[model samples]
Target: MAYQTTLGWSLISSGIVTLILKVLPYDSLWWGLLLLVLGIAILYLRIS
Candidate 1:
């Protein structure tokens, strides 16, 4: 239950961040990659 909630929030937050990054004029490839890595790390930590 808690894990599901965490995963849901993480996805939501990552989506929002991705959208915001898309809107910015600056290059976001690195930022997006960083966020992806961070999100994966978070999920890995939660699972273990």
Candidate 2:
């Protein structure tokens, strides 16, 4: 996949996670951080 495509998908996934976090009442720093890290990992794997 192209760089833009991979980045787009990663952003979309990350946005979805953010949206879910926003929609839910539970607020925790770890969940957001974890999702961000997970997104970055996926992007790295895709690039490699």
- The top-ranked prediction according to lDDT is 1
Model 1 lDDT per residue over 1-48, tens place: 999998999799878997999887768987888878987899899999
What stretches of model 1 exceed 4 Å from their correct place?
A: 33-48
Prediction 1 global C-alpha lDDT: 0.87
Expressed as tens digits, the lDDT of each residue in 16-43 for candidate 2 is 8778887766665777877779868987
- TM-scores of the models, in the given order? 0.57, 0.53
What's the true lDDT of residue 13 in model 1?
Answer: 86
Candidate 1 lDDT trough over 10 residues, lowest sum: 24-33
Q: Which pairs in model 2 have colliding backbones?
A: none
Residue pairs in collision within model 1? none
lDDT of model 2 at position 2: 100
